[model samples]
Target: MSNDNHITIYEHEILRIDRGEKRVSVNQLKALQEFYGESGVPYYSLIHNGVKFCEYVGVLQVGDTLIEILPKVDKNLTDSEASWRKVLIDMLHAVGLFNLQAPSSSNLKLNSNSILDLYFELFVKEVKYLLRQGLVKKYRKTEGNSTSLKGSLKFGKHISQNLVHQERFYIQHTVYDTTHELHAILYKVLKLLLRINTNQSIQGSLKSLELEFPEMPDLKITEATFNRLHLNRKTQGYHNAIEIARMLLLNYHPDVSKGSNHILALMFDMNLLWEQFVYVSLRKFKKGNTTITAQNTRNFWKTSKGSKSRMKPDIVLNIDKADCVVIDTKWKNIKNYNPSPEDLRQMFAYMKYYKAKKVALIYPGTDFSNSSGFYYDHDKYGAHEIGKEECSVISLPYNTDIRQWQKQIALDIYNWVEVNDESSVDC
Candidate 1:
């Protein structure tokens, strides 16, 4: 490939730099430094002749002039493969950009120019639907000086400040208002979307929506704001849409210093993405007397100075008040279909600490056969007798149809647990 300003590389693939060409410019270096400082994850790895890339799988702008480099797709996927498109869809869904209630059509394909393009397209669609229904409104408290004292009077402030003018008295009223939490959230979303690099259509749509929003100062929305929202018939429809917009805006942190030269790119770690997908999908199986928990943490070891170390299992199955099964999701290709020693040791710790009947290690890929023997027996694969507790390494296949894949995963898990639970009871 010739020395072009824009470059795209795949995941785990190294890009070599020519001896004469400048690889890392000063401005790119500064932007990268700032990105690392803010995100705390090294986006790229610099080596002697080239750079070893990491989790970020999107376009990155380097230098003050904003030269764009598109990172490589996953190590398993080729650039021209249709699977890359699926990966993009999964990425959007993982970040709550896609609506979960409306399942993605099996035949639907995105003609997006870029990831941000697709995001803005969907965002505009949802916003338009919301507008058709009219914006959500609530009774917000209004405080000001009133001549007739329409609401509760602040006698202390009224007497101190307005004693000279007996005509006006300071009062507060809880009036039915449209400019409440929902409008504040929507306003922030519009502002953040405008900052991103998008097409003319999206830009025009956002501007139109902006005019429709109430004239309120952008409010810093926190987790508390989401919790405080009362979801009845009126606000329930907008809940998911508002949340998706809120999350995207919150996660968006771009280098605005490059002015108009910088490209808008959002990247997600496959490791974290796989974990989140598994956790969310597993929740479907939570039936009577059973509960599913993700990122379940507990102190497994204690230091001599009284400090405690924690053990966090990715997914935990609590059956009848006991931690029955612990699962850990891995985002790597297993060699010879065997779990690595390090992964085994980690799962072993969970089994010991939680007294779990079984521990499962899940990976993402579809090469393996979905047969019964896929699960590793106790003595097999060097996971010999620590106890009667069983350990299984399962692969969750990545299919173009994500909904079907998720359903298969739920069934696999349910069956695995049902068989194991019966055997354990007999023992």
Candidate 2:
């Protein structure tokens, strides 16, 4: 079994394998290379001697080692990996990935090495919560031979299969029990953690779950399975657990050939996460008749062959259902206090197409400031006057108290919008 050794690094940082440092074995490196090749190297870059981590922030377990790639948004992040890990966890909680309701953050040991243990603890708690509330029983169709006749019987199947066994009957019956897909997935996850989870604290809980959870048939999980799952008020509590299960089961890849170096990579696309985080914060803290939405799309160009190209801004704020404040989120640092030329052009295009006077680009930074400016009207002659349309390079400062930071996003946007366009709605 792989030990709980961890290699912690930030985005865009390189970790070289050597005896002087926490290094991977030859087989482990091969496994990493294999994963990189299979996943198209999106998470990290494979170099000759080491790997370069990228914008994807999460834990990747190779062999027994956990490579924790954390998000480094703040320029002044003087703290160690522990601080950033906590920040990532907090952001996840804020975005409703995992609820921080149970076993509060205060109770968790900040010194614990890998981020995986924290997630394991959360999953354990969620299952325990379900057990306490009592496992929900669902009606599942079971087809088999039984002595006692129940539901509708398949006469043909019974005659063919139960020919020698005169007392047996092959029939399709409906069973109302807790051995359903939801419990099955939870059981499967518990089984997984029981094998790979290194947290001594949760080992007993894992064993308990194994005993408590019903033995469910191995389910073939797919996106459609989750899509078809409709949670009523009674099953609403299972949402968090199901969500976590979706992440785990989907990302898991078992080593069938070797049966040892099974992989479980739970990485988040930092750009998407940042975009959703901002979008969720805006939605949560928005006050008034104003509305905020993400991925408000419009098809900009359609070819002669009817190939359509679409333009979708990350976020858009519509006021009184009148005007739009198109906002594009960049999960990057604006170190130069200047927006990229391509980005500025993108914002300009959005402004013209959306027919809005104001659009903004939001970036993560240490200081809250706006590099405000206007787009210049152009003619054949280069010299021109300022146009009425405007774009601002806005910075969202990082706060350890993520809730407060989220509220501040709305306030900042409200202040920015209302200050420029007085006709816009109030906060």
Q: What CA RMSD would you report for each candidate? A: 6.7, 4.4
User: lDDT, candidate 1, residue 67?
Assistant: 26
Q: What RMSD value applies to candidate 2?
A: 4.4
Candidates in order, TM-scores: namely 0.68, 0.87
The models' CA-based lDDT, in order, is: 0.63, 0.79
Can you give the lDDT of residue 259 in candidate 2?
A: 75
TM-score of predicted model 2?
0.87
Question: Which portions of model 1 show Cα errors greater than 4 Å?
Answer: 1-9, 13-29, 42-52, 56-82, 91-97, 100-111, 141-175, 220-233, 254-265, 279-293, 303-307, 316-325, 354-358, 369-390, 407-427
For candidate 2, give the lDDT.
Answer: 0.79
Q: Write the per-residue lDDT of candidate 1 for residues 40-111, one digit (tens) a residue.
A: 555566555556567555545442222223332235454453356456566457545566444222222377
Writing each residue's lDDT as its tens digit, candidate 2 over 16-107 gives 66642456667777777777765575788897777877899998887677778889986367877677887888788778776766542224
Question: How close to the true structure is residue 203 of candidate 1, measured as C-alpha lDDT?
Answer: 84
